[model samples]
Target: MKSVDATEFRVGGSDGWTVTTSFNYNQWAEKNRFQVGDSLLFDYDSGKDSVYQVNKEDYDKCHTEKPIETYKDGHTSIKLDETGTLYFISGNCGNCRKNEKMVVQVMACRGSCNSAASLGYLSCLGVVGAFVASLLL
Candidate 1:
């Protein structure tokens, strides 16, 4: 996640999912599109106090039972496992009205087998290619 300002954050993909701090709920959701096995990181800003909570709809689908709290200038991580939409909000009362909510879209693998087998096959091919190259040398 990237910090845009004292009260803003952003997300980007490094080895995984990434996001940027959004000013509104809809903006956040559009920016950070979540997938299964992905995670969301909230990087809080200093001095500017804030609180974050997931939307009730998201909590129900994921069976996430937790209360919201004030956020610090660091990283808050949330993992996505199921396929659905996740929403979040800053519980900062008046501040919330000033654009302080986040959302994410989580998608699951489509087919039964999906791309797992394909990935494995590609890995095997890579190993074979390396071995053949070594033998030739």
Candidate 2:
């Protein structure tokens, strides 16, 4: 996957994953923007699941790590199903400073199993045809 440094706050992957890290919740939310079909993974040292999202207007009442999926080793996964901007902030005040956010893009597989199977069948047919011609000669 191709990766580009999206400054200290964010990192972008060619596959379609964006990673972001920030100490301040408000700062991170303001800078990063999310879109539909995008996936987000958060990396934290301690507070993996401790993340929250709030609407732009009412930032105060919006505090919960509910939407965010936490990982054991400072990692979180979020899939952006809806086409809208998503905002997040570190719940841990202390760890926030050191936390670095990362974005990972999930790329679709280039070929499906059906395609592979068809190619294999074609190849076997060619071999069989060649063998039969040689025997007849």
User: In lDDT terms, how accurate is model 2?
Assistant: 0.40
- lDDT (CA) for every model shown? 0.48, 0.40
Best by TM-score: 1
Q: How much is 128 displaced in model 1, in angstroms?
A: 21
The true-structure Cα RMSD of candidate 2 reads 11.8
lDDT of 1 by residue, 15-130 (tens): 11212343344654686545665666665543453345566653334222454444444566765556886666544434444545555677664333234444555557687774
List residue ranges in candidate 2 displaced over 4 A.
Answer: 1-34, 47-49, 57-73, 93-137
TM-score of every candidate: 0.47, 0.35
Q: State the lDDT at 78 in candidate 2.
A: 63
Candidate 2 lDDT, tens digit per residue, 1-137?
A: 12222222232332111224523334444465544334565544453335544343322334333434334444546665544444444454333334322222233323222233444555576877745644553
